[model samples]
Target: MQQQRSLQAFISRPLLVPALLFVLAVGLRLVYVFVTSTQNFLEGDAGRYFTMVEQLLTDQIYGYGSEKSNARVTPGFPLFAYSIYSIFPFTPNVFRWVHILIGAATVFPVYSYVSSVSRPLLGWLAGLFVAVYPPFIYMTNLFLTETLFIFLLTLFFASWQWMMNKPSVWSVILNAAVLSWAILTRPGMLPILMIAVLFLLFTRPARRLLIPYLLTVGVCFLPWTLRNWIILDEFTLLASDSGNALLSGAYPFFQENPDYKEMYSLGMSQTQYGVRVILKGFKEHFLQYLSWFSFGKLYYMFKSMWVSSTLNFPQLYMYGGVLLHYLTLLLSLISVPYLLIKKNFLAFAFTGMLLFQLLFIPTARYGAPFILLMVLLICSAAYTFWINRSRKPNYKLPAGSAS
Candidate 1:
């Protein structure tokens, strides 16, 4: 009986659910990794990242080659790869395994963020959703920035929630630090930081720590900006790829026009040329540009899971995954008004992020990081529904008098 009670106690521990979710997450990802072990990792953007890591190792440079260091891409992922390659042999399987671990560990923050705001059971559900999400598992197989960026992004949300709840100096600093790393991982995330700063300025409990938060962010960003300014002779805050991103999005359906290429061939800076193309496109095709910016980009962003070409899966699974993606998005959108009515700050920040992505090229890969957030919102809505239903008084006809 004592042994039985001890087992029950262990089972009832607060962390047991998240721990089991983490194990399940790791197991699922491991199965996928081993099955796809023979697949090539150096595909698409992975090749560019691999090349950057190679340059960092042998040439001690961060750019494409030894010619000159450029800020086209941020150093976070390459540095992450470099740290791994420094210890282990540069092999695809090793990197994938490490990424699998990093990807699986994201479950904790998802659980923490959800559990803090709602019940623990909903938190477990959110973590499970992340554990089995198809695109998140597939992302670990590629040597791209998505895995690391997603992990950091979730951690940022978790830390932000923690600071809001407790309002400690250390938590404030930690939130700022996570935000800095997130921006460095994906320069597009810079706007989210601005949104956060604006939110904090208005929030009472967190307003006092805003200066420390900004100072910490500035401290974290200083070295990278200084490096870009010194080596590339440009004051690139995060990266120099925004121009290409703008140009890519300037066209409807991302199809480049001949005039865009002609303008680029005239030796104009990419940023300037991209701006000109956008202005011209807006002037020439106002309605088309408006639709593309508002709804078209949103449709493409959440349409499908970004699967690896080499990893073959059943068509049923792909269809089901896409169906689930749409369902989650729909449910999350339905929950937004509820969240706003309750004055949820995180909801505003997340909505701001979704809106901010409209300014760039639309790709499902960009939406992968927010899968956890969508799951959290869905679980929150579900939990609220369950609670409301349970609280309702049961009504029945007395003595079956009704017909």
Candidate 2:
């Protein structure tokens, strides 16, 4: 009895929950990385990032070696990978290990932020979910930006909430800095940032902070913009791949329309081509476009069980992970209405994120970025259910008191 009580007391320490979760998160990711490292060496975007790092270290040049330097791909991941390679004896395995550590450390920000606003139990639940989440663990082994981007985004949201509560210029700058790093890692965050600024603009009390916040964000992106201008001779803010992403989205239309080939033959830029195809698809094949956007893209975004050529894991694990993801998703839906009614900013931010990402090409990998938010919603739902269940029914005592 004493031992059990001691164990409970230790676990109840303020820092213990996140600390334990971090250890578990690291252990899980490290094991995954160890297993997959033997089977897969950098492939797909992983290969490109690895090669870019190699080229940067040896040749002192950036970008995929075949082409001249351009803003076609964002430099954040390549730069990150190169920095790791610079410190350690360069190997693909080294990069994976570093990311494993990063992926594990994410638990701190996630748990700390949620615990501040909600019950400690719910906060631990959110952190634990993130620590063991299969998609997040799987991505840590890859060379992709998902791992780093998610970590930064978690920090960004946490800082954002803190700033809103405190309303200090220092907090605003800190939030903007984290957000800028997130955008650097993945331009997908650009839309989410716009949504946040819009939120500030419409809220009467927050309107005063909006201008400074926007300016700080803009200033953060200036260095990258200048780099792109110098190298690519273009005034690109993010990457030059937005058009490619749009083209990927309009793939069905491209297959059906013969005129797309003719349109492509014109000397228009990729962004222009992408826009023209989307407009044409909407005008000519509205039904197909609607179906593709609604069902096809949504399926891609939410799919959790699909196999990747890159990672070699058992089929059973994939299916199990998918089942868990679906259950959490359902629970999240149940809780969202309640959150909105309560004006929870986190839930609002999450909804905005989904809507923004939906506008672009939707992929499970892209959706992985929001898995932390999904966990929070699930925990919220469960907490609400438990609170409702545990409430005692009240009985009338007015007659007895009067007597």
Q: Pick the candidate with the highest lDDT.
A: 1
Query: What is the lDDT for 373 in model 2?
Result: 79
Give the number of the best model, judged by TM-score: 1
Off by over 4 Å in 1: 1-11, 37-39, 65-67, 258-260, 309-311, 314-320, 382-403
lDDT of 1 at 30: 90
Clashing pairs in 1: none
Q: Give the TM-scores of the predictions, in the order they appear.
A: 0.89, 0.87
Residues 1-403 of candidate 2: C-alpha lDDT, one tens digit per residue:
9999998898789889889899999988877778654435476877887777888899877766343576777766778777888899888778778888889888877876776666787788778877876778878877878889888888887787788888889988998888888888888777678778877888898888888898898888888898878877889887877776766676552354334566557977667876787787779989888777676677777866323643455667666677778877777777777777666666777777776666677777887767677777656556666766689677777865964
Per-residue lDDT for 36-89 in model 1, tens only?
444467887788788888778888888843346888888777887899999998
lDDT of each: 0.80, 0.76
- The list of candidate 2 runs beyond 4 A from truth reads 1-8, 36-39, 65-67, 252-260, 306-319, 380-397, 400-403
Instruction: Report the alpha-carbon TM-score of model 1 versus the true structure.
Output: 0.89
